[model samples]
Target: MPINSYDYYPLSWYPDSTRIKRPKYEAIITLLEEDIVSGVLKANTKLPSQRELADYLDINFTTVTRAYKLGVEKGLLYTNIGSGTFVSSNAFKSITISTDNSPAASIDLGLVSSFEQCNALLVPAIQKVAGQQTITQFLNYQAPTGTAFQKEIAIRWLSTLGVQTIPERLSIVSGVQNGLAIVLSALFSYGDRIVVDFYTYSNFIELAKLFHLTLIPISADLEGMSAIELEKICQLQEVKGIFLMPSCNNPTGSILSASRKKELISIIKAYQLIVIEDDIHAFLTAPFLADYSPPIYQSLPEQTVYLYGMTKFICSGLRVAYLVFPERFKNTLNRSMFNINVKTSSLDSEIITEVLHSGLAQQLLETKKALSQEANALFNTIFDCQEVTGHHPWPYFRCLPIPKHYSREYIETYFNQLGVNVYHSDRFVVKSDYEKAFIRVALSSSSSLEVLETGLLKIKEGLVGLE
Candidate 1:
């Protein structure tokens, strides 16, 4: 039975309104979950309305709404039309705090990180930096963007990716995410419209939400974001920017072709849209193969903000990333970087500096390519996945069409029970009604051939079971 809205006055139960070390919305969700489980708020109890809670707590109404949405997702709350939100009957039963004895992860094929082999080179590089006579500089403060010497090394690193840019246009960031946040902050404002692929990087989607920017998802083909679709979208809306992974897109591993790049560049010029070319995986795109086409940065340097970083190819422990800002936006980007975090670690900069100059970076890349070749062979044999889109050096992930027998929900449950974690196709989609039938298999997440083979075999068995 639904509780009458007037039956329950706004319970005075609230968390410590003073100490807010975490996000306010998350804090609210935690408090609500705690109260529900402790029986302080019985099941079917009508809670305070979002507006009333916001007014009482003196917090944003949207924050309360977000908390309620998250609570619903976690099965802690339910809502009724023309009524009010109430605690779910099973909320206490569903909410169980995880412990160490929880089922161990069978395999994680979701996140794509640096190859394990990079750790070998990273240790020695750090040791070399520790032994340097100029170690005092690592302890001292540097510019928020980066020092001139760090930028010089970064320029050389960018050249490896075929990006030729001066240091004045470059800003050193802690990682690619930080660089992206700074760039987005500098270029766009709240409520601004930006364009992205229908299936794009999840992190970029989260970043868009953080900035309160609207992401218009455009349908794409195998070659990547469709320029024709983008043109139509630009005609329809006043898009401020376009965020894309041209060389090696995340999850899907799709690359934008040269002709399409030219076509998109034409549209970009016509619309004067700010372009963010996330070339993080460019270096991972076949270490041995020659360049087939120039990057968009080369053709449209003035409009594109090229993001290059070491975290993908090198170990993530060295959180080093460099952004080539358009010369006109230097002041804006520098100011944004300062307000975010003063600067990246000087020690990390020095370590990457040593690796780039000493040729270890190239050696590490070659090792990664070799490992990728071996892993791809295993994946190919298991799934016979010819439709895989990523190129050599493996692009860190492969997006394959989901077998017809299994719903994505079924696959998620099957694998999750086996302690395997996989990213569903819908997770990467920008639109809620997206119907793409695909799942991303992170090729690089498994630490070894044994683990990769085991995970793939398990997926194969699950597919067969569905049949």
Candidate 2:
């Protein structure tokens, strides 16, 4: 069925060119939502004329107009008569749709962050700090690398993860993302090549773009990045650094094997490349962590800047992280972090230091690991998804194979109607040619076991293409 075409300006924003099962309007809605949330469409960025978008997509003009109208209603877009339509300034804020016609409400399975299991300890930890007689110490400005007391706690936490470090080499940042930014800005220049897995964390991809760094994606398999391929790339390019999440990596949950870690580190030494090892999920994967691999920092301690994050397992609100920098780069890292952040969060640093010194942090982590196991078990009961269970901590993401004849967008929309939201594999790809018929089901964000069960059942039904 073809609608009459209308002549209009050429629109550059186009959805994936492949054939799709979702209606044009729904597809456009999803595209706008994703682009706005991902910062691809900047705030107040003007959108092409509705007819122009329709013509570009070969969709009916009325369908494009309807999509724009829905976008506006959903707080994702706004139109100015003289200037045309544009992404809303507040497009990144929570989107509230009228609940009358749509299915009850959607549960978020896209965000991987989880701290609900640790709130029992977290709330009291906050209160305990609030009541401290020396509480005023948290109100004053402190070093950008945090106070000596806080650095000591950071070092103690790293020791548990098998990365032995001292207070002298530790620099505290707001979170793991901030630590990554500091390392990249302080150590490497723009256009320097940094290697990562082909399908890596979305945040790292965006960070690479923001910092103007050249990302060389190495092909990876079930066990994680291919050391053989990485060696090939190193010989061909002047690689500066390698970024990895060795323990319970995100999205795929692929852990780098012990032998492979040693192999990769040998190559790193040969190439004289820096290693930015992200170990935020190390604590979560504690049960199985010891059996699989040691931290890369252990092998390449002189070249690795180990990012140990406390936000995931302990409390996201605290926003505290510890970076174990190479002793040689200490002066440069400290100066760069100081310029970027001015100072660390005094309150957050003090609270995390107290949390670690007390036995609460360990207990909270144990409880979280157990809860994650339970959640993974519950998920496994309903869907024939990936094997993301075991001792690994963040059971938030489960990669499911797409059913025959279903696009990621089609499956995502089917679940959307059932009040469950998920992210497709396309969002995490580092290479342009990367394609996969799969979706990432995040198990951590549902409010309760009951909600998770409901969402999982719906997801299961959709996976089989059942109505």
Tens digit per residue, CA lDDT, model 1, 68-119 = 8656543457788779888865454321111232335658776666776558
* Tens digits of per-residue lDDT for model 2, 280-308: 88876654454756688887889989998
What clash pairs does model 1 have? none
Model 2 lDDT at residue 434: 50
Clash count of each predicted structure: 0, 2
Q: Candidate 1 at 296: error in angstroms?
A: 1.3
Compute each candidate's TM-score over C-alphas: 0.77, 0.75
Stretches of candidate 1 exceeding 4 Å from the true structure: 1-104, 387-393, 403-410
Badly placed stretches (over 4 Å) of model 2 are 1-104, 287-292, 385-394, 403-414
- Quick one: best lDDT, which candidate? 1
